[model samples]
Target: MAEAAEATAKTMLGEISQGHLECPICFCRYKDPKILDCLHTFCLNCLDGMLSKQQPSTGKITCPVCRKETPVPDAGLPGLLDCFFLSSLVDEINQQERSLETQQQATTSPTCDACEEGLEVVSRCIDCEENLCQLCKAAHVRYKRTKTHRVTPVEHPEQKEVPSADLSKTYSPKCQKHSNQEMYFYCETCKMMTCGICATIDHRSAEHQLSEITDAVRSYREEVNDVLKKFQKSKEEFKANEAAVDHARNRLKIMVTRACSAIQAKEEEDIAQIKNKSRILRDKVTEIGKKRDDEFDKVHTDNKKKMERAEEIETAVTDLMQQADDFELLNLKPKVMHNLEFQKNLQFERVKHGESFIGFKCQDVVRDKDLGEILHEEKWKLQSEFGKKGDWDGEFNCAAGIACFSNGDIAVNDINKKRLSVFTSTGHYKSMFDLNAPYGITVTSHDLLLAHCEDHVKVFDKSHQLISKFNLPLTGTDSTDQCFISPWSNNKTYTSGITVDKTNQVALVDKKTGVTSLHSLDGSLIRVIPNTKMVPIDIITNKKRCILSAMYDESELRCVDVTGKVNVTARLGQARPAGVCCDDTGDIYVTVHGNGLDKGVGEVLHFDPQGVFIGCVARAMHWPFGITFSPSGELVVADYYSVKIFHRV
Candidate 1:
């Protein structure tokens, strides 16, 4: 029991020494503790040291804890508000420590404050704040004034507990200016507790709103509770967000693992195919080598037989000349001469040039064919639609062409209305200007607008003012004839679709000759793409400088390089593909005028860079013609009567 009591005493002393009893700056017991406006308390000497380090001209000092600036009292550190509650707590802790030490040492008991003679304290009165012996305790209960006070036996000072009434009687801090009066009110303007005398004097101004301290505390508590409720809701939202992020992370991990497995499987399959091809090539090489060796062997055998025949004939002719008579030599001479003549006329075949060399030609990995492509299989939904078939400012009679500015503004050209209308990205009407037979439109890198009108292309500035106009050269004719008769069927030459390449070269499609030609900004012919098989309706350019033409006659989307090399030619069945455009990711979008029973209702189809069909983006459109992507990557399609916008979800 004694050991437990000592331990308890040590714990209480330790808590007091480390907690509110200690000064934050001094890291020791607080001496003359002063509270700042920020509600942080520190030793008076520590505050004085902090103040002395600052410039004397500055009347405010920053808090050492929260860095909030507090005005210095007029009389300096001594004029700061004293913390009377903390002072009393420090004294109570000190007294408890001494009492515990005396109990541990088994010293004499404490004397009673109410006894005249020196008498040991038997009990303590909570409300009267006095210690009493047995005799004084009896008298304290018997008196009328002190009889209502609650008293408890003081057998162990360490284990003493104060009554609730005693706790309510704890000291209220006095005002800094009026030291004799306790602070009773709070000045809302100054945000400070003030004594009654100080409230009537310093805080009596109209700007200062004074409230009783108890009322102020109650109101502030409610306000803090409301804020705390909001904070709790925010905390729950953060937790929900965290959980969603964790789920996404897990899903990403699963996708990565599946992708890795697929890549490994492809790698194994490709390696096996390569090995099989290598075996076949090696076998072919061996067969060719053996055939060449056999041909060389046959030539060697024929040459060796001729040499042996000549040697034998030489021996026979020599023997007949030495040993036989002249008749025998004469008889063999004709045969020997015949044999020598035959040998002299004979010639050996030589190996052909380059026959010994065997070469392996390797195709380019990136350019010859795509090893793989990073495809964005994004799905789009119709977000909004604007404009209608009317003569209004925001309406279009025949929305033939569409273009997007770098600032997300959309420009639509109406062929029937003969006007170019501009709208915000959200499809709100901005302005319109008069134009003639505008079919296709595009915006240049410098934000200049180019519109294909009849046989000429009109260039407009950012303000929709005509800057210049250039006549498109007639097909098969060098002259820039604005009105040239088509040589094919005597039809007038018409320019339908137009697009600008990366090098600022314009590609204009002529429906009469079924040929798309590239031209400079000044309308000088660069070259013609040899695509005369199908009538080209619309054209666009990708990042690779390849022109994508929508062939309405052939129902196909054709992609060709600037040099007329065909890259991809995708057949769209019966749908007459038109209004071709590419996104920032190089994915192709073609608006098709539906065929068969679905005539008049058009659909927008998406494709990869290589012209592989991805999916249908938008369907059931009323003759969609021109297509373009907004600056924010939204799809803007110019239908016959309205402009439709689609966003990737």
Candidate 2:
């Protein structure tokens, strides 16, 4: 009985579900009598046929979904089920359209509804739902919208617009209790902004900080402007500094040019002086020579006249003899002829009574035998060889002085090597001497060596045996003060130079307070030579009286003749002179470094007896220090580094 009941319920449910969906035609469930007012329920193709009615001659119809009225009516039968989903879909479409409209409205946010203007309004009107500012608040807008809206101040911290759509919202921009209308500036001390009423009532008696906005703005501007001004000034100062550097560079260029010009001018002046001196000497010498020639000519002429007179007497004698012979055979007056000849000669001699005076004595001016080796231009060119080598075939630190031996050996003071090195002329090791920190070296003709070092002068014999030492007893070490030992040693303790005169006279550097006593071979102070105001850099005495001492850093290379009178002078302006030597002809050669470390500029200048500057013998050498002429007439230049040999021309 229950199963029958359930089946009956299922059948009824099916029947109800079948016609449950409504039809557009009758607005009711579909029935077997299919009607839409005309009883059409739109069954698939039949519904389309009915819907697409002929549109005035064309077959077209309005769609029910679009709410368009059909132009034709069809007599097709349909059920309610087919149009059910279409009705439900139409309901869903309408609902979704409303949701899309809502989303667009939310996306636009709240904006003014009334104005056409696009200005950004931070505040809004309550009643009119419009946005504006204080100046644009028209009373009519509020008054007209008063029925439905209200007006008030807006306050939204981050958002510029009013907190709500209505301008009637009130926000306290000021204190309400004070009822003050103006915005009082904040006082830093009080840390608050007060209304006028509050200022006069509550804050008037309180100590507080306050300032006008205009004054603060102005002060800030001034401070910033002051910093800007300083920056500008600094920029200008930097430019000035750069300009000064450039100016100094230009000045240096000018100074260098002027210095060069000065040196060149000096050369011209020196040459002119040499020419003048030579001319003067030539004039005097030529005048004297002409006088001698005139005297000789007169003597010759007188001697010829005497010879003629003798010849005439001879002829007269012959004639007298012949006449006597003729007078003996007829010879008359022969005795008177010979006597007259003699008397005539005597008379002529008396008339020309200057017999001795007629001839010149020239033995003093000429005829002196020059036996020494004379280097002439025709014989050989001047050749020089020099080199600095360690004394003991070891390393040399720094070469301070150098000297060469006669047999191709050279000696150098090795300040760094701490000993001297004797090397062959070709730079081969030979032998060396041991000594203290040596500063100077002088070689004697007999192979005796003299080296100057700290406070003592060590002397050595030819075979390198220690002979003895020379030193001044005065003992005080003051750099600024004058040295006493120097005057005694060199006649000046400034023993920068030492040379043994050919006669073995120990010559010391003087001209400064350093020179003093120079010892003899016997070890006693033979002489205490006094130093002059000048310091001699190098001292050399041939011993016959020609003491050639070259002065460093001075213009004069002075020579003292045999009479002790200093004559042969060489004037060199601004020349850093070093060593000097006198060749056989009395011609002197002086080495000029021409500015220390100015290696390429060093040259050797020759001077005549009258102090004439001949051209450079050699140039472009490394600080040519010591110079000497070899017995072979070769000039050896002892440079600080290398020794060069130039053949004397």
Highest-TM-score candidate: 1
What is candidate 2's lDDT per residue for 1-649, written digit by digit as tens? 5346435544644454344434455444433322121112343454455555544443334434333333333433232222323343334334444544444444343333445454445467665667665445554345554534555655543322211112122222455566555434444455445556666776666586554433433443354345445444544443433333333233233333333343343334443434443344334434433454454455445545544554444443444233222111111122222223343333221111111111111111212321112111212233434444443354443454666666756676654455666766665666776666333677777777788665567887767788788764342234553322321123322224666656666655432244434556544666555423345556566425456767664657876543446655677887867767765444567777664345568778875444556456777766666666655456766665666677533
Tens-digit lDDT track of model 1 for 269-346: 554444444444445544554454455455455555544444444443444334332222222333334433433344
Off by over 4 Å in 2: 1-397, 406-408, 437-439, 473-495, 510-512, 560-568, 595-597
TM-scores for all candidates?
0.40, 0.37
The candidate 2 region of ten consecutive residues with least summed lDDT is 353-362
Considering every candidate listed, which one attains the maximal lDDT? Answer: 1
- Give the C-alpha miss distance for residue 114 in model 1, angstroms: 99
